[model samples]
Target: MSNRGRDTRTARSRWSLFGPIVAVGTALAVIPLWLDHSGVLMGVAVLGLAFACYAIGFNVIFGSTGQLFLCVGALAGIGGYGGAILADTVGLPVVVSILLATLVSCVTGGLLSLIAVYRSLGVIFTGIITLIFTLTFDALLLGLGSLTGGENGFLIKAGADTFLRKRIPPYYVMLALVVAFLLLHGLLRRSHVGWAWRALRDDELAAELAGIDVARYRVYGALVGAAMLGLAGATYAFTEGRVSPTTFGFAQVDVVVLVMLAFGGIGTLLGPVLGAATFTIVDEILIEFGQLRLVIYGALVLLLFLFLRRGVIPTARDFVAKRRLSQASAAPD
Candidate 1:
């Protein structure tokens, strides 16, 4: 095939891959605009979108690269608090603060990746290292009582004059972020760096032998994932108008994100969004269950893993494709 023909084929493949994702995202984006104007539903949707973005970032590292950086919540907290401090304390503009906060998260992620990847730590060890960071960061947030407001948490005054104070704006912002990250994930999946990451993920030793810079790609994954998580955190702070240790701690960060990614279809483009949406709705419904909520939720998630190990989206995709193939085979030529 000619180079042009190959390029055309690649372009078509890319379109085929992302077309459904884009269509679904568009439909979801219009929900808040045209659907019921209930504050409760709006709030749930906003939270779901924000976490969807966060889960996507987490998926980039753990799902795509097979490196478990479990401190997603901590990274997000850094962004949320960092943005708040910059905007409130230093009096920076909200946009600038958000950008700086994202940068900080990226740096933190890269540093963590350096420790995890450059050190050539095994998967379990990497998770342990990130878990330590998450715990330590939570402690740090509490210890910085004046800055983070400790258990009381700090209110975000920035963007007060803007639409961010309202639920709708934040919801739209989060939706936009989720869509952007999904697109970015798709692009990265087709890029050379993505190839390197996948190569490393499949077989690190073999990838290294093939001259792929395993450490560099790992760091790249960390940086990209961290940046997205940080952006989500900043949006969360803006939406809630507060930053608390609990919001970005272990429960919210590690467990929630992992569950979302796993349930949605790890490594798939639409999995994080689907997972985040599904669990967020579940959370809303189970909120009234109080302590038993966790039990019920855990049982459900366990069932999902037991039955559909690859996750709902990927498994469904496989089933559909297989059915189509069988149908084509049975069809007369």
Candidate 2:
């Protein structure tokens, strides 16, 4: 094909990827208009957006490079607590605190990746180490009760007087972040870096042999992903007006994020958002279940692992492909 033909094809390809992004974003944009009358439902929608951010970040690290950093909640906790402490206690600007906290989380995530790479840890081992780190972080929070406010937690006094204190503004803010994250993921998926990630995720040794720096790329993914996670966490602290040990605990955040990523189809863009939205609505419905919510979630995870292991996107894509092949085979010669 001529260069112009190639250019045309590339442009079309780019549109194929980004068109859905714009549509999804536009659809999400109108959500507030629909739920404006109900504060509780709007709040749930915002929480879903937050979980979408978390699942996206995790997808970058684990779905892209197979790092399996299981400290999702712990990392977010760092950002939330750091922002809360700096803005509320240290009297720093809220923006500055959130940025600083994101940096800290980014650095921490990078270091964890480096450790895993240097130690030659496999996915399971990396998860184990990160889980230990998560537990350690929880303990440290309690140990430093004076600062973290211990079991009681502390309110983000700095944000109390801000727009975030209201329901509608925070939803838009979170929606903006989620849309931005989707675009960022799309751009990365179209880049050479994305090729490296796919290669590494498929076969790390082959990727390394092909001149990709596995360690460097993994660290880069972790850094970008962790920064997004931290920013979401920090901003949520201000929006929710509080930070607690339970806020980012493994049971509260990590499990939900993991389930979302799995259900939406790991490694696929928009999977996080789909999964988060689905589960968030389900959660609201199950609110009447009380503690049985966890049991139901556990059952859903089990069913997913047993039946839909490939997740919604991949499974649906495969089904469509198979149907097309069958139709083509059945056509007259």
Candidate 3:
């Protein structure tokens, strides 16, 4: 058998054990509905799913492409505004608004990618550019006070989906999105392009030596990541019944996106999901501090950086993989 085929088979085998585990875990999610405060539990589930989607997109740029773009929240904000404008001002249906918003986000994300790739900006430079873009976008919203309601933010009218209106539907919708994202992640990870991405991420020069178009792959990753974030943002906008420029500013952009990426594990598919959920819950629990929330959040991120540098998901995954390998090696041939 060819070495590539062998590698593929090995990778598949390594992940096979997780299939049943995931299924079981998914089944367990339904148990929350049987509880008394199912409403809040459902809210947690939905929020977890949404943030997971955001994390996956963040990983596409930071994890797969070896690049940094700190405008995740800003891009998501754009998408939210795009949807809101379509629904409110243009009188379009919510579904149509969502579709258009997603398309707009993808186009914007691609444009960013083209510029970044063409300029050959390093990681730090890319972050700076994106950060500036986010700030500028925020300012533009403020200046467009007539349309965006200035600092007041905009809200959406009620819809048929009680789940969305309350929190249950959004949770299920997010859960479905998570499933779709995992499928996409699996497909990408198993493809030749996925290999190219990993190669580029590890060493761009070496990847180029191996015939990978580093710039092209990087652009692809950024677009894909941005598209996901756009989708998530559109959904979040609908769920919250509002969109605000302030929510997508620099503070929310980097700390939440990157911290989730770090706390969950940077490279793995599950990292962002796990990290986002963890951070969300942590933030809620820390909210009683009123003003100390940010301080505690910073400290938590610092602790993760100093100790669990690779993040929890990646570290746990590696440990389990190793243990399974050891067990398999010890088994009778």
TM-scores of all candidate predictions against the true structure: 0.95, 0.96, 0.88
Instruction: Please report how far candidate 1 places residue 236 from its true position, in Å.
Output: 1.8
Q: For residues 149-170, could you state the per-residue lDDT of candidate 2 as single tens digits? A: 9989977789788899797999
Point out the higher-scoring one by TM-score: 1 or 3: 1
**Candidate 1 vs. true structure, TM-score:** 0.95
Candidate 1 per-residue lDDT over residues 178-198, each given as its tens digit: 888988988898889879978
Off by over 4 Å in 2: 1-4
Which pairs clash (backbone N, Cα, C closer than 3 Å) in model 2? none
Which regions in candidate 3 have their CA more than 4 angstroms from the true location? Answer: 1-28, 31-45, 158-163, 320-333
Count the clashes in each prediction.
0, 0, 1
Best by TM-score: 2
Summing lDDT over every window of 10 consecutive residues in candidate 2, give the lowest-scoring window.
Answer: 1-10
Best by lDDT: 2
Error of 3 at 110 (Å): 1.2
Model 2 gets an lDDT of 0.91
Candidate 3 local Cα displacement, residue 205, angstroms: 1.0
lDDT of 1 at 99: 91
Please give the distance, in angstroms, between residue 104's alpha carbon in candidate 3 and its true position after superposition.
1.0
